[model samples]
Target: MTFNLNIYETMALVSLILYLGKFLRSKSSFLTKYCIPPSVVGGFVFALFMLAIEMTGVATINLDITLQSIFMTTFFTSIGFTASLKILKQGGFKVVIFLGLAALLVALQNTVGVSLASVFSLNPLLGLCTGSIPMVGGHGTAGSFGPMLEEIGVVGATTVSIASATFGLIMGSIIGGLVARLLIHGKKLTTVHDESSKMPPTQVGDYNEENHNILSLKCLINAACLLFIAMGIGSIVSDFIQLTGLTFPSYIGAMIVAAVMRNLYDFTNKAFVEKEIETLGSLSLSFFLTMALMSLKLWQLFDLALPLLVMLMAQVILVGLFTYIIVFSVMGKNYEAAVFASATCGFGMGATPNAIANMDELTNRYGFVPTPYFVVPLVGCLFIDFVNSFIITLFINFIS
Candidate 1:
């Protein structure tokens, strides 16, 4: 029987089954639960598995790059949908200041990545990919761009993306709490507006006043049609934009189209588009991140050396200060708003989900959000990433 076991496939099955088991067991809390963010554990454990198997000359890892692309695209669509242009409107100068500082910090972060790679005698581009590019930005950005960098000759981009995401997840939760508590003590503002509640549904067009069946085929049809239309229109417009000799990330173009379509739907009072999009997006992100991580080739990193680790440390320190002192202090309105802004800053510069997760943990534990949860999710999932893509391209070109 040819003893075939694709290492990544095996690891994915193992990780998912393990995760499901823990879920079924009703385990709780990030601190105690064996859930150290499924991606991190999945990727890490899988790498170890591959190392063991490969060393014995038993198996090799094969990543399905095409599937990775699809999942990554869908995930980015979700990220784009979550952006809230409204809050950014109200935020005005604060948003400007925050974006500017964040842009500079990310540039510094890139520089730090290059420097670290040089120190470790590894490719500097690889350092950038794993350091802050994707991991901190979450699965959407990291996985979406990993293969692209790989095409550009940056090896081990996937692993670095996973590692960065793990670090971002950890830092996001901690920084959120610490900032919230500090703001309270410093008397920077009054009243925390975090209402620890479920993330509300996206605003649909008209609430059908006539209470109808929840499982109606029409509802499902409407939801599916909306997504289809959004996807279709988004694709056409994005292509047109690219055809015009301008460069934009694939997701950004899709999101602008989606957002525009959504706003237009709102005007026509038929705005039920993107309903349950999050479910689809989340599922895609989970699998995408999983596949991206499952093909861990640890042996490749044996030559990475120590200089790279120091560069990462420097970048982390820089981001921390940039977030705390500049972004938080200057963020807008009351203390609660500032905290949210601080967290948002992290998301724009780090990971959007991490941003919402941080805010979610904060509100869940504390209790007051002046800005609204939907706002953050909207911005994180949609608008910020679009903006970040543009910003990144600009930064790259400028540096080059």
Candidate 2:
């Protein structure tokens, strides 16, 4: 038997799964420690259930995941909003250097992945599933590029990418602290005392409750409008890029358009409600990821399991060494560099949140180091995605 769900049904189911995932995360320390997203947890469980049913000859499910693409585009569009060149300049020279290091890692990751895929006699495109697509790119990039790779005739790409991303989350968390500890203790680096380094204060008292609610609503509406506009224009941009005979992700155009709009606003000194846009993007990402995970074809992954494992293991090793030797030394061989190394391991193999978590753990255990806190997030979250995406696109076009 086969069960089909329409778009509304799919959305409802995804929402429920998200709640379930959140509840599970609340109860499970392992999930919390690893910083796994609730959508991933819930959707992965649902996928597993579907896999079990199929294996038992019980039933199959077909989900109308039409909204997945929209949600994905919206999230990437929000990321584009964050790509403010003005802010990059404000972050100063270290941010640029850190971004360069992160970008180099992206290239190295693809090189390792593609080279190993050849060694295993697998399609080089399949190697990308285990490359920066999952490692530096995390689940967001994996979800975006997985389907693209599939369209390029790479079977099981989505499954492999998702699986590799999950693995990265865990391994990134585990190794990040260890590497940082090794650097700090082995080199005997002293912690810096900077009590003045803290987050800037928010303008919370400017609006009363009624006015605040009204403002929030207005901001949300504007954010939605901007996202749709960018996405609409981005389709044209994507088409234009395709005219160049290069394969790029569909959201790339939207992201670029969004970035341009953001910078224009910055140039005009106009107030943009970034928090509202970020919230909207987070909501969209949850839905998109949930739908993507729940719709996974797990059976397709069986054939590529060994090669996938090998590729993932190699990536973990690469990230560790790269952070320990290059990132630490180049960033300056001090306490801040150690923290930066840990942060790099986190985001290099997982997500920026994992990087933050690693830094938080280090700060709490040792003393607080402010430079890494500032520089890592700026580079990892804002700049690295743009760099990684461009590099990945080049790799794809070159290999294809």
Candidate 3:
């Protein structure tokens, strides 16, 4: 039997899975410690349930994931809104340096993946499924690029990419602290205590009930309008880019337009509700990820399991060395550099939240160092995606 869900039904199921994931994460120390997204937890469980049913010859379930693209575009568009050059300048030289290192890592990861895939006598594009698409790009980038690779005849690319992303989340969290610990101990690094080094409190998502009640409606409306406008204009932009015989992700144009809009607003002293936009993007990302995971064809992962593991292990080792040698040395080789190395392991393999969590654990144990706190998020959250996407697109065009 095959059961097909309509769009509304699909969204409803995704919502339920997201809530379940949140509940489970709340109850599981491991999930919370690693900063695993709730959607990943719930969606993976649902995927496993579906897999068991399929294996038992019970039923085949199909979800109407039309909204997945919209949600993903919305999330990336929100990220673009955060790419204001003014903020980048405020972060100073370290942010630029960290972003450069991260961009380099993305290229290296794809190169490693492609090289290993050839060694294993697999299609080179399949190698990209385990590359920075999952490692630095996380589940969002994985979900985006997986289907694209599949369309180009890389079977099971989506499943492989999602699985690699999940593995990265675990490994990234595990290794980050270890790398930081090693760096701090090996280098005799100690946190510098200075009142000037304290960072300002973040106001990005401070949605207290009072504040929510006051501004939620207007802010949400404005944010929705901006996202839609950017997405609408971005489709045309994407079409134009494709005319040049280059392949880019569908969301790239929207991201570019959103970045331009954000910088224009920054220069013009126009005010928009950034907090509401970020919250909406977070919600969209959860839905998009849950839908992507729940729709995964888990059976497709079987044949490539060993190769996937080899590629992912290679990535883990690469990130460890890159952080220890390159990131540590380039970022001043001090206490802040140690912390930065730890944070790099986090976002290098997973997402910005993982990076922040890694830094938080380190700061809790030692004293707080403000430089990494300021620079890491600025680069990791706002800038790295642009660099990663550009590099990945170049690789795709070249490989194709």
Candidate 4:
């Protein structure tokens, strides 16, 4: 029998999984110590269950994750909203340094991926699918480029890309926290939140909302207005740009729009409550992640298991070495660098949300550094996708 779930049912299931993950994490030492997000815990467990059922030749289940894109887009829109020019100015040289390094890492990921594919006598394009396409690009990019590879005669491109993205998501989450922990303890690094820090107190979903009635309502409406405007105007911007024959990701226009709005707000001294926007973005991210994990068609991954494993293992090692050696050293070798090192794992391997979650977990344990949070999201959300696409296209052409 085939079982299907509509969007609302799927969301409800996702919420249940989140709650279960939270409960289980509360009971488990390993989960607590590692700082695994509740969504990862629950969504991943449910995916494994579905995988088992498929392996057992039981009923096939499919989910209508239509809402996934909406949530993901909105989550990203929130990141765009957070891109305040004043904060970027404060981030200064370090932010630019990190962005350059991260762009280089995307190229290296494709290099490593293509090299592995060549060594294994697999289709060279298979490595591209497994590389930054899935790793740095996350599920959305995977979904986009996977079929393209398949159309060009790479068998099972979609399956491989999706599987690689899933692997990266889990690994990124696990590794980011561990790396941060090591840096914090080994380097004797700690942070104390300063009111005068360069970071605004607008962490996604975190704020002092003691006055949750009138203020929250007003702020939510304002944030909603701003986000919707960005989304609408951003689409027009994207369309206009595409007409000029220079293509970009769909989210770029919206993000650009939001950033412009944010800076304008800063310039005008408007009371744009960033905390509410952050909260809304956080909620969207949680929903997006849960839907993404639960919707993984693990059965599709069975055929390419061996080769994909080799590729994934190589990618994992590369990200680890890069984070510890280059990312840490170049970002200043301080407490913040260590945090960025951990967050970079997420940036390199998974989506921005994963990177943010990693930072959130570390900050929840240690104190907030704030700088890395601002740096990672801006790079991960705004710039990485732009650079990654170009490099991936270059590699694909070179390899093919």
Candidate number that wins on lDDT, 1 or 3: 3
lDDT of each: 0.57, 0.88, 0.88, 0.76
lDDT of 2 by residue, 1-400 (tens): 9889998988888999999998898899999988899999998999899889988999988888999999999999999999999999999999989998999999999999999999999889888888899999999999999999999998888999998999999999999998988998789888654324544322122111123323378889999999999999999999999999899999999999999999999999999988788778988999999988997888888888888888999999999999999999999999989989999999999998888888877787677767787898788778788889999999999999
lDDT of 1 at 356: 57
lDDT of 4 by residue, 63-155 (tens): 887877677667767877776767667777877898898888898889899888888898998998779988898866775566567777887
For model 1, residues 196-249, the per-residue Cα lDDT tens digits are 444442332222223332455665566555555666677787788878654455
Point out the worst 10-residue segment of candidate 3 by lDDT.
Answer: 201-210
Error of 1 at 100 (Å): 5.6
Please give the lDDT score for candidate 4.
Answer: 0.76
Model 1 global lDDT (CA atoms, 0 to 1): 0.57
Q: Tell me the spans in candidate 4 whose CA falls farther than 4 Å from its real position.
A: 118-129, 133-215, 241-248, 328-347, 350-400
Q: Give residue 233's lDDT in candidate 4 (0 to 100).
A: 92
RMSD of each: 6.2, 4.2, 3.2, 6.0
